[model samples]
Target: MPTRPNYNQSSANHPIINTNNNNNLNQISIMNTNVDITSYVGKVLNINQHQVIVEDVLGQGGFAFVFLVRSSNQQRYALKRMYVNNERDLT
Candidate 1:
């Protein structure tokens, strides 16, 4: 079995309510753990000053995971998370 990552939820103690209005603020979370694609659903990620909420996994490979995400402005985007085990892979 794969171990799930420990992600810090934006409002773990508070219940999130969607008002059907897109003006609501997006929740935030900090990710720091091994990638388990299934665990990323419903997680809000902060990237390049934008808040992207992960909806589902679109694809996956041995070293990466592609997600179908929605931005705070209700825009859909593909977010890819890649992993490199060694320094050589950076080149």
Candidate 2:
């Protein structure tokens, strides 16, 4: 009877799963906590307890400001504040 080749042994030499890929995966696990928000004002409008505001001065013909907010559950989100010519124009 012929014996089957060891598939497990072949997988050990696979090019896709190597040392370099392992190192990259380790680097991605690190978290970044240092970010400066002071210089962004004017460029940024208002900053709330859970969000950051910034001006959309480019006049893309859409919104006026942008906001970065964090949810109660810790999820991060971006909010856009549009420009309205009149207070009543908002809907």
Best by TM-score: 1
State the weakest 10-residue window (summed lDDT) of model 1: 10-19
lDDT of 2 by residue, 1-91 (tens): 9543321111111111111222233221213223232233334222333323332111122333233333454443444334445435543
Model 1 lDDT per residue over 62-83, tens place = 7666667777777677666665
Residue 24 in candidate 1 has what lDDT?
28
Which regions in candidate 2 have their CA more than 4 angstroms from the true location? 1-63
**On a 0 to 100 scale, what is the lDDT of residue 35 in model 1?**
44
Compute the lDDT for candidate 1.
Answer: 0.57
What candidate 1 gets wrong by more than 4 Å, as runs, is: 1-35, 86-88
Candidate with top lDDT is 1
How close is every model to the real structure, measured as TM-score? 0.56, 0.29
Per-residue lDDT value at 2 in model 2? 50
